[model samples]
Target: MQSLDERCLRYLAEAVGCGSVRAAADKLNVNASAVSRQIVQMEGQLATPLIERHRRGVRATPAGSLLLDYYRRQASDREDILAKLTELKGLRRGHIDVVLGEGFVGDLMSGLLQGFWARHPDLTMTLDLAATNDVVRRVVEDEAHLGLVYNPPPEPRLRTHLAMPHPIRLLVRADHPLAAHPGPVRLADLAGHRLGTMHPAYGIRQIIAAAERAEGVRLDPVLITGSIGVLKQFVASGIGVTLLPAFCAAQEISAGSLVALPLADPGLDGVEAQIVTRLGRQLSPAAGTLLQHLARGMAGEARSGTRRSSSSR
Candidate 1:
């Protein structure tokens, strides 16, 4: 068997990263023809076409994507190893990517991440705040080292690490009629209520949809908004009612601006604030350390019980 040169693989990686043979060649300070010829050579050696060129750019074929995945992970592992060796010499530096949901963006994640950075000034971290499903996909695809997600989508490629047990609660203004309702409220009772919610892509939204389906009822939320802050604001203004993770509305509930009510029938028995990562992707040392910190932070929150409603407690 002929061994492949590490340089050719690196060149292919650069081309894949740039999405252009010419751009990769320019970046490598080589001729575009050379890059093209090398790509052809690589395809012939692999016995498959790696990329499909288009007017706009190029895209990897399925086989190409699979090879890229292995190649990228190898590269990432090599970099991680070097970073660890550098840390031994007091050079401690590397980059990590994290994707989080919107609800965590303003408060929950902000302080934690800032503190993490302060503690490890040499490590570079990039936080990408996105919708729940997007965050899940990023983690599964190895695009992110870790993900802070809520009501995560079902995927076999990722594993959920419990961050905080965030119980889902019904939110309404302090003076709203539902706030004064006597006993445990049922899903049937909320059938026609004005419910503010995020887009369909959100995990919480999916949870709600699942419950509705389980109950065989159709819920017509009066107002559907994408932002959590906006939904809270609307709830505070006595606009509508919606289910939110208790932690997300902790401050408002404590301030008496919003009422957090527990749903009796299904309850939030399985509701969770999760840390997601690729099931088999190797974590860099820094990333592993940071993930451990994140788990600890979430454990603290769970212990504090400030995020869960009294009924849930």
Candidate 2:
């Protein structure tokens, strides 16, 4: 067999990623026939079929999966090499892709991004907001360099760089009745109150569900949404109380518009926010530095929360 063509390899990777040659062509701004031709050439070079089509879309054959994996690693390694060369020139220039849950956006912007960007002005970063599962998938697939998730499930392919306790709290307007609860609020106490919650895709919702099961209760939220902003607005408008980490509503709580109360449920009390990367993957220098900054910032946030809790006591 002849040496494989890089362009053909890229076409194959994109086709598999998009699940169709037409979709890949649309993404790459090329003709579908051109993309298909490249993939066919690649298959001929390898002497094996690269993709199998079904009703839903296309999937890689076992051999195709191996080739795709090799393509991803090669792409990542090339980036690493370029980053190292930039570092050798004393230039802080490289792009870092981060996939994270929407809940982390406020803290990331307020606590980390600006300062990091100021110090490494030549560097570029992309932040993509996704659900917990998508965040993990992107990191594991080499599509992103880092992930910030809340209470993510255990995955062997990921490494946790930092995990900070940011347990679920009952969020309500200051004048709401639950705000005056003397201690941790129990699930039973939430009875007869209006409830708003995120859609099940969110980590907070999953934690809330588990807690409800453990305590043998069910919460039927009047409002269910995929947006954290929507949930915050729902509470602020006095529509109902919602469950979230204290830091998620830090600004509102500090401004006295919303109050975050502890939950009595053990499962909710143990939730954490984590920063993760692909296990065994070497990070670019810029990405590594930003990770350190994020870890420190997150630690500081946790410390601040501790101080606030102590002072309240």
Best by TM-score: 2
Each candidate's TM vs. the true structure?
Answer: 0.81, 0.93
Candidate lDDT scores, in order, read 0.78, 0.88
lDDT of 2: 0.88
What residue runs in model 1 are displaced by over 4 Å at the alpha carbon? 1-39, 52-59, 89-92, 106-111, 265-268, 306-313
Model 2 per-residue lDDT tens digits across residues 106-206: 89878489888878889898999998888898998899999999988889999999999888999999999999999899998999998888878778888
Lowest lDDT sum, 10 consecutive residues, model 2, at 84-93
Per-residue alpha-carbon lDDT of candidate 1 for residues 120-238, written as tens digits (9 for 90 to 100): 88888888878888898778767788999987867888877765667677898888889998776777888667888888888888888888787777777777766888888888877
Which lDDT value does model 1 have at 133? 80
- Extract clashing residue pairs from model 2: none
